[model samples]
Target: MLQHSAILGGGMGGMLAAFALAPHAEAVTVVEQDAFAGEPVPRRGAPQARHTHALVSGGARAMEALVPGVLAELAAAGAQHINLPGRYLGLASRGWFPRYAGRQFILGCSRELLESTLRGRLRELPNVTVLGRTEVVGLQGSPAGITGVRTGSAPLTAELVVDATGRRSRAPRWLTELGFPPVRESIVDPGIFYATRVFRAPVDAGPEFPAVTLQSSPRREPGVRRNGTLLPIEDGLWMITLSGGPGSRPGTDAEGFRAFAALLPHPVLAELIEAATPVGTPFGFRADANRRRHFERLRPCPNGFVALGDAYATFNPVYGHGMSAAALSALALRTEFERRRKPGTLRLQRAVAGAAANAWDMATGQDARYPGTAGPGPGRFDGIIDRLGDWISASSGRSRLVTDIRADIFALTAPPSRMRSPRVLWQAVRGGDNGPALPDPPFTAAERRVLGVRPR
Candidate 1:
């Protein structure tokens, strides 16, 4: 039986892991390197927090069920609730997609605020302890089993160690230190880079603005690379992110960013930021890749430990799969923990890693669609998936059949198989007119002035 659990990070995955274990273990401690204080400010500890982060409805439900009152707390703290299909306006390589009502929704807020709220609730649990300012440097025990984690400042022993250390995790090295071979790994990197800036909202169109995205059209005659997004976060602010991968890179300067946004398929991103009050300098981040460790395939796995979130797999942040995958992983952990209550069982460890397979496949599978996506080429089935995704994107603008397929895909509620349904096939073949090409988003007259678009 597991008497205690030690989590080796304080990010979303780490925090969720603590929550999952708190109910099963006699005690749970989260060893975090940074101190959580002040009004949820960004820290160097979480680089992605500085970028735009949102919770899909699937993740939101999982988190709310794991950490009580999370949704209420987030809403009270200024997170915007957005209906997924009905409220989102996106420009894809094919064309603009018509917004349709769907069963799922998304919550938009700064990553810091979401973490701080969850941290606060978690700290209140009697069996959980937040070991603030504590850095975990290594693992304790042999490859047969992990007894505990050895930290930089202080070494603590526990029955189980959970690594939720995000992308820069030392788990692999630590495993190697214990005599285990390198975990089976896969990498599909598009070599994406990001430049983002926060601006005060020019208009009170919070709910109406509809999170706008202009996606890259790589499958076109001449492959192209570029994408832009405008997300409405907390405090009457909007976060605009411009990204390019491989040979394409967004500029670091403010004027350059604005100019780049202006060139995207739609003028929404540039228009939204043109006249808005700039609140912060543009932040840049690179090395965003899709990598995964297939721990489930190992013949003999270490006991008393498992890696989740970015530590286990990292998706290209451009797709916004990080948090959703983390939530799914946490649920997987809970399922495995419930299956085998024994703490130091290698069987249980293997099972936990096995549970993350679906999420890992989902993230890397689609990231492979980008042109010049550097990595191993996909198998025949993967090629079909990519082409079908493009087909659905082209047909979704007009056909309700494609709309259902799209809603299922984007909502993260269904597997890729949803696109193959006979209903979708019939509609794609018969409904030749996939509706008229979508127009520019419903921007107010003021928004037109901001982008300097002449009256049409």
Candidate 2:
């Protein structure tokens, strides 16, 4: 077991990492720059928390494994465990999805609630220390490998240092200062801005109201692609997020937010938001770029340091995979530590890095098609993959077997490559589901009554 370990960042990823490392280490320290409030509220450090965040199945399971019973805590806090495909009116690029039923699900709640729940659960662990309101300035060891971290007052030495500092991570610069080579990185920016508003859910909207998702097709004509997602969060409120690139970026005004939603691939999101009474002012966020730091590719990756979560990779939030990927990486950290019974092992870093591979592919593959996407475009083989993805998305709505597999891939329970498998490819080729595409939002009669959506 490790003598001691330090996690830099007290966000969900950092806290989850501490949970993972706790059983394998004598003591765990989670350092963060912001002091969390006693109640579940968004912190100044996590601006993205104001927007809607989804806890996909992959992430939910990982979070449960590391911090048991937290799901019940979230539910008790008013978060809805909305089933995926089953309780979702998802509009894909090809067509609307027929509500599917299976094992996959996501937690619909504010990021602050998720973080607060984690913070609460973490308090129960006596061996863990949450050092908040402290800034991490730099690294303390040589490039040979990190030995400790430098904070504002004193350096905290640990057998292992994990950087979960998020997208703004300074690990690369800190390593360079330690005499290491520059860390290579890849970024794909869709120039998209997200605008979100909380609505007082329709009076009759029950706890089981299906989540609504509108997806944009990036493979079409080169122009602004718009998308929207509305889900039932805590407090009997619905959080609606509308997204668009460049000129089409969602506006700050309430009218513009609804307009953006209306302009999406479909009008269901727009219609619902139009009828629901808004609880608060509309807000916006723009740091949704997908960035990846090639830490694993670093020769003999720093012996005592590791990076996970947004520090290692970030995805377009619209894809709703960031938290899940982070949780998976944390789970990987625990698995590695238990197996090796040590810190900073080569296997650990690689495992953590590999955990984000599927999310990276899914984010970049879709974002690269945007007209003004920053950096390089998709690989030559991406076109083929896109075609296969479209077929799967279209067929899943009609085929239960195909739908189950597709749902797993999106939920992160299954690798995206599974869709490319020979058997899956054969299924796609032969067309698994046989039926006409859904022509409109597939809302059940009960759901229609709740949302005031008129039946066809």
Candidate 3:
């Protein structure tokens, strides 16, 4: 059994890994380059923190299981819980999803708040230590196994190491330096860009204000896609993010940002913010690709090391799956450690990868459908799956059952294969009565009154 564990990066994945390993190791250290001393604030390392982030039900459950009462703590911190379909104002590729009571839900908040809360909780663990402003320069040991990590000239020895340094992880380079063959990689870039700004919540807007999303449809236009979301975050602020794929990228300037929101399928997002006071200048981010490092496929893999979070894979943040996926990975790590009397590094690494598989497929599969998407295109089997997904999407806007299934998948509570079940398959094949497409935003009288707007 491992006596010491070191996790690189103090982000969600790394901190959670520390929690997972604390029970099995005598000492667990998280090496982060940022100081966690102030009120929850955005870190330079996580630029996209300013954008809208969703904590799906599956991830929320996993986190609650790990830390116990974390969800309640998050709620106390002003994170909003939005029930899927029931309280959401969403326009999907197919049509506006009908507002109905939902079984699944998502937590809406700034990334900074979520990470800070988690960090605070982690600090309470007696055996877990977070080393801030410490950069991991390299890994220690050979290609066969890692013994520790190198921080500049100093070496922190540990029996196990986890790489959660996100997209900037240098694990491949470090492994190559140790004479290991390069790991294969898969990348899919839809060239998605995001522009976000914060606005004071309108006077009438309340905690019950539904989160709004205008989803882009790849099937509608190959290279041109634009979407927007307005999430009510803490402190009576609405975080609005406008996004586009390739040809329709949003700009960083204020005017351009507003223009992008206006270009979405509906003008509700733009109109909502038209008279509202801006809290800050518009910020822009570019997530160039969804990249996966095939570490699980490595033969004779290193014995004492594994990669987690964005170190293993990064998805287009538009899907809002990253944080949740990290939580699931942490849960997987805990499970493997508990199940095995003596968990091998390779076995644990594979288990972590398995935890991330569903999210990877969900994000990349949809991104590949867009035109100008780089990297390997969908395979023959993937093409078949795409057709089925298209059918579901088109039908979901009309059929409540299909909509529920899609919502479940989006919340990460159900696998994509659930749609292939006999009942759902029969529904898909027989085609239910899909009501007419919504002509305008489906805001209720109360919601409209809160926004100070009338029904279109």
Scored by Cα lDDT, where does model 1 land? Answer: 0.75
User: lDDT tens digits, residues 327-426, model 1?
Assistant: 7778767767787766345554555455455455665676566667888877878877668766755654567557655555655566666777777766
List the candidates ranked by lDDT, beginning with the highest: 2, 3, 1
Candidate 2 TM-score, C-alpha based: 0.95
TM-score per candidate = 0.92, 0.95, 0.95
User: How far in Å is the alpha carbon of 347 misplaced in model 3?
Assistant: 1.3
User: Which regions of candidate 2 fall more than 4 Å away from where they truly are?
Assistant: 219-222, 392-397, 450-456
For residues 1-456, what per-residue lDDT tens digits would candidate 2 score against the true structure? 888899999997898999999998899998899995557877877889888899999889999999999999899989998886888878766566667677899899989889988998888888998888999999988867788999987789998999999989999999988888888898899887889999877766777888998877764345667888898998889999888877788877888887777778777887788668888799988855899998887765788888999999989888899889999999999988777656455777789878998889877877887777887977898778777777766554466666667678888888777877776666666666657557788887777765544322
Q: Best candidate, lDDT-wise?
A: 2
Extract clashing residue pairs from model 1.
Answer: 398-434
Q: Deviation in angstroms for 369 in model 1?
A: 3.0
Please give the clash total of every predicted structure, in order: 1, 1, 0
Cα RMSD for candidates in order:
2.9, 2.3, 2.3
Query: All candidates' lDDT scores?
Result: 0.75, 0.83, 0.82
Total colliding residue pairs, candidate 1: 1
